[model samples]
Target: MKNLFFSVVVMGLAACSSTPPAPDWQLEAKGSMDRAVAAYLEGNSRVEAAELARARAQLSRTGRADLLGTAELLNCATRVASLVFEPCAAFEALRPDATPAQLAYANYLRGQAQPQDIALLPAPQRALALSAGSGAADPLPRLVAAGVLLQTGQASPAVITQAIDTASAQGWRRPLLAWLGVQARRAELGGDAAEAARLRRRIAITQGSAADAPKVLP
Candidate 1:
């Protein structure tokens, strides 16, 4: 009887030892995302890419549906970074239960991918979709709406100028530079040399400030 009990105990211990422990996927995913954001803010593209890859890998291992939205957002951002304009499958497959802001951002990304598809929605509708912000949350949508309006030639230059000002005040570096370029071109085309020169100077100042800013890593 003692021999049989010993054998059973040994077998149980062996089985337990052979089984692999499950990963804490939630913590892994969060950590990877945090690192990715830090890398992006620090302008370390290689580290950002690696962190995003790690996040995707960790999310993939879990097989949890809840992580799908986050995974899709990361994938879409990656596509944008690579300048890949095709609509992201993950974004297109967003669940209907997603928040209004999420849906608006997804739509913006989709519009970016399909610039030639003009009939996606009217400019006003697009603007309305992105208009769900109060206080500091408003700059990105306003910038996106301004870009859309500029592309479609639906808004006056003043509207775009206001959007650019709002974005610049909020310290958005790249978008401000890009829109300033657009405005400079418009000024040149309209025979306003002084305005164009002023815009160019603004661009230079913004670029210099961006260069001087310290990068933050988490």
Candidate 2:
């Protein structure tokens, strides 16, 4: 009876454990923006537009206007706009908060920023490491970081290579492709011409010929 009582008490305590709050506007906005971009990239324009709309609405509701200026939020807006072919809206959205790196990334995604700008913001450099800001399940900030790396030209070789290598070793291939694709363009700008070419070739093969690969052809 005592053991049962103790076990019940422990279970009750565990059930009562508190969860942390959501991130502030900066992280929240970035996360929403990242989802919008991902939807766009995956050719889901409806979901992309909805996410972008949600992000914009959330940003508008925020009393903390300065949160938009952070590296995370602005980059997310830029990536979503670029993917959805809404460059003007994207630039307008980020203009108020654009850091030099952020602006450069936006412009590069829009085909206006210089290649050098992209190269400078490498994969490792672009990631805005979030600590204690958001929950681990929130992939938004990481997705935004990935976008920054992508916009700044650190995606292909280092970023994708790292993800693939990690995924291969960990058997985490499902999320790896989408995550790595977000960063692949960086290699295209960072002077890894051969690597970039190879990556593009792989992408093309996947897009064009993946269906042809022998599987249960039924």
Candidate 3:
């Protein structure tokens, strides 16, 4: 996910001996998906919206509602990595047309997936989709893994710190602030006032607000 090589997902495609020529949608979707993710994590909402719209349009070319739903799932996944927990309303609108695989992925993203859902997940997501653990080395995957762990009631201080460090190292302000906020909250709950203040300072610096950092974890 961090490297973004696996950004575009060609939903409902079965593996074949020889890969066929890439579809126009696949090519366009991949680039758009990559940019959308980078823009979202880097805190550029305008670019993220435009790129995600472009990717959705490309996926719509196939006339498969499931693909459209999958596009929304990808968008929600990026949002989740940045600690956004709103319902995936876009995917919900297309749910009636979605396949079991699509539903499985939706559940996986929501932390309500079943054991069967793991196989339906993209490779980078499978490890965390399966349990309370991290998998890939890429910063995005780790951030995603940390997000899932937090969702599943399994995140520890270490998980939050790692996610914060990963986002900071990548200069991903959105997730960096989000994760820092979470760490600060945890520190507050644990009576580590000094650590909490330090993290709040970092969050304030990022957001240009000296006020109390907003709650990003609930």
* Candidate 2 colliding pairs: 107-113, 118-152, 153-186, 154-186, 155-183, 155-184, 155-186, 156-184
lDDT of each: 0.51, 0.42, 0.75
The reply for model 3, stretches above 4 Å from the true place, is 1-21, 208-218
Model 2 segments beyond 4 Å from truth?
1-20, 23-31, 63-88, 93-97, 111-218
Residue 216, candidate 2: C-alpha displacement in angstroms: 26
Q: Give the Å error, residue 165, model 1.
A: 2.1
- Return the TM-score for each candidate structure: 0.52, 0.37, 0.83
Better of 1 and 2 by lDDT: 1
Ranking by lDDT: 3, 1, 2
The sequence of per-residue lDDT tens digits that candidate 3 reaches over residues 63-96 is 8776667668777877778888779999999999
Q: Estimate candidate 3's alpha-carbon lDDT, on a 0 to 1 scale.
A: 0.75
Residue 103 displacement in candidate 1 (angstroms): 7.9
Model 2 error, position 138 (Å): 16
Best by TM-score: 3
lDDT by residue (1-218, candidate 1, tens digit) is 11211121121111222346534764566567666644543345677689878877876675543355545654454333222346657646655544443454455555542433223433433434344212232343455455545545554777657766865775655456666777788888999999989988887776674443322211
TM-score, cand. 3 = 0.83
